[model samples]
Target: MDFDDTPDEAAWRAEVRSFLEQHRGEHADARAWQATLYDAGYVGVAWPVPAGGRGGTPMQQAIVDQEMARLGLPALINLIGIGMCGPTVIVHGSDDQKQRYLKRLLRAEDLWCQLFSEPEAGSDLAGLRTRAVRDADGGWRVSGQKVWTTLAHLADYGILLTRTDPDVPKHRGLTMFVVDMMAPGVTVRPLRQMNGAAHFNEVFFDDVLIPDAERLGEVGEGWRVALTTLMSERLSLGGGGTAIGPKPETVARHVAEHIGALPADRQVLARQQLGRGYVAALGARYTGYRQLSKLSRGELPGPEASAGKLSGTRSARDLADLAVRVLGDDARVAASRDGDSTWQNAQAGLPGIAIAGGSDQVLRNIIGERVLGLPAEPRADKDVPFKESVA
Candidate 1:
């Protein structure tokens, strides 16, 4: 692919840069800044115009992301809505759905959380037990629980997955819904991690009522809907790192500063590990470019995109581990010393990436089967009825 930008692309980049320079000279509240981005026609530039977007090319979207990173702007506040939920709604939502949701979503006017993972079903999302029975009035009454919810406490709405029919096979009995978070019977309790932050939460739905109009797709089609969300999710989560404290360069600087005082063999090993990490990080950057290239074409990021996720996450984990080793004593009390211990907090959260989008083993399985044409894993349960399999 030609690396050079065409004249129009260059002009678009220039426009984004100019807009940033004039509007935000320093860090700002995420909600306010994103609203400004929406007004300035910078957010969701590639989404369809009918969905309250600029109808810009995916290359334009890439330019916006690049400009935000180059300007050192804080990460967008409503990443889940813009990156995952918005795209799914654009593809599958009714006109009213699009009209009612997209504009507010882009502006962060309505924060969204995803309710897919349950205590029982996480990686195997089809095995979710959250039931949604049809009420007498033809609406749905949802009763179940979801865990590891990132922002349920702060959300105004949620894209929910439910087991609409338990008698059928697991994958074929699910349904998706757009639920109002403030409605009665919705409960969100904070989950404190070892790092002492409660960013994640557990949400319980006890007879939560979902309007008939809020169903995302036809019954027994939740998996298809969830796939759309998951496609966007892989791109979003895979693209962003754990965002923990001290970056690779910061730890490297610490290592270099203390290198002269270490024993000779120890110094050699430290330098070697550092070199390996630098190269791995460099490779991950280009792999990320490949992912962006796929996304820019408006294609759902394919299995190969997992390579980017794998490389980026592993590199992050390596850096986090290296930081702990480089700052052995400081690491011990880092979390206790400050709430903003970027490195320590990062180390604690980095392991979650292994299982976040997909575990390393899971990604490897996908790459082997989908990318390499290898033998697929045996699945005796694939076609069994949900009740039978559970029993």
Candidate 2:
């Protein structure tokens, strides 16, 4: 894969850098900065210009993201919209759906959340029990509960996966919909975490009405659409050049500062760990580059994303542990818990990385099945009808 930026890409990078310079230290309103970026054709740079993007390449998009992260700029408010739902809509949505969602999503004027994971269907997402019964008037009544939904309380809409025809096999019965968060019978309650942040929510949908136009794909085609969403999610979550905490370079510096204070044996152990973590971080970064390379060449992501995530999250957790060990318990005070504050937030947040996108175990299954060409896991539920299955 080509690694160096083309002349056009270099020009785009310079333009993005200039825009960033103009907005430095003015990130108080993240949405405003995002709006500015979108207006300047920086947001969704890889998307088609006709589809409210600049039609840039994936490698250029990666470069833009890298520059933004390097500048410590606040992220756009439409994280799920841009990263997951927008890509799905672009691929599988009807023209009207695309027209309604894509531009607003890019500007952060409309936020969205994924309503896929239920209490019982977190990892086994296809086994979800949420039902959307069709009415004679071409709308559907949604009834179910979804847990671990990030930003549901703040979302304007959600991409919901529901069982529309339970008589069929579980996977075949599913359908996806775009539900208005303000619709009647939709409820969202915050779920407080160990970090005391209500980052996710428990949502209850009691006969929420979704018009026929809201359905994302054909009846029984939800699984395919949902796969699109999940694929985008895997790439966004794993290949986004996400750093869980301080860069390993920063950590190495911090560790070096304490090396003189530690005993000889501990110093050796610390140095060894630092070296290993640095190597692992490098591996994860290169893994992301590989994914970008594939995307640049118009190839879809594969199981290697799991490898990136497995290594990246593991490295982040290890670094967080090292930070806590070095900083001691006093750093846990909430008021002092900045990004660099003892890595308390990182320690609390690292577990979600392993669980979110897909669990470490689920990722291993993908790697085993796809990368290694191993035998597929036994699936008793494969042909089971939805109503009769024990899911």
Candidate 3:
């Protein structure tokens, strides 16, 4: 793989940086800044033009991301929708579905959440029990609960995965749908995380009606559709820079300005932590570049996706811990009119990065199975029909 960018890539990077400099938010409103990026066609660079994408290659897309992070631009909040769900819909959706969803999704007109994980099903997504039964009028009646849904409270729509034919095997009996969050029988209750934000929620669908047109794929093809979503999810979640931590350079500047104001001598530890974070951040950037190169060449870096996630989670958590330690007692407080307050927010928010989008442990398993070519996780339920196995 090419480590350094070609001259054309350098030009693209400059263009993206210029856009970010002109339009990005003023050190806050990170989500809003992302919306601006989307509006500028810098966010969905790799998406096809037909899907409201810029029709750029994955490498070009990664260049945009790298440039944005290098400029310390805050990430967009609708990343899960645009990066994961939008791509999946583009691939699995009918033409009408794409026409209806992709532009709104890319433009953040309708934020979306994934309704897949349940109390019992996390990594083993096929074991999900959300039910979507065919109604007499050929619509779907969905009923179930989904937990750990990020931004569900803010979502205008959701991509739901539910069991349609339990009599079939777990992977075969499922179906995927695009459900309006405002539709009857849908409820969202935000879940408060250890971080100071309520970013995720528990979403319940009680007899919600979804037309067949909203269904993403053929009957009994939910798992296949879900694979597309998960693939995009794994790719997007793992391959980004900046994450939840204050960029190392940002931390260092803060340290210089506030060293005397902090408790005890924090300079050494803060410097060390910042150094480690920079290394990890740089490593993730290179790894993401590698993956993007592979994707541009029509290869899916499946197993290596886990490696990026593992590194990202570790880097985010470590940076948070170190920043918190460096700040000592101040980390406990919410904020004040000071630079340290920013670090506190970063500290409180960093652990969440570890837990969200397939936890660190899950990443390890993916790496083990796909990259190492280890013995696959044994499954007695693979061949059984969904209904029979559940019974």
150-196: candidate 1 lDDT, tens digit per residue: 77888898899999888889999999999999999999998987667
- Against the reference, the lDDT scores of all candidates come to 0.80, 0.82, 0.78
lDDT of 1 at 24: 68
lDDT of 2 at 372: 91
TM-score of every model?
Answer: 0.92, 0.93, 0.88
- Residue pairs whose backbone atoms clash in candidate 3: 166-387, 168-386
- Minimum summed lDDT over a 10-residue window in model 1 is located at 238-247
Query: Runs in model 3 with CA error above 4 Å?
Result: 25-39, 240-244, 252-281, 293-302, 333-340
Considering every candidate listed, which one attains the maximal lDDT? Answer: 2
Ranking by TM-score: 2, 1, 3
Which order, best to worst by lDDT?
2, 1, 3
Candidate 2 residue-wise lDDT, 276-316, digit = tens? 88888878877887787777667876665788888888887
Per-residue CA lDDT of model 3 for 142-190, tens digit only, reads 9999998988999898899999998878998999999999999999999
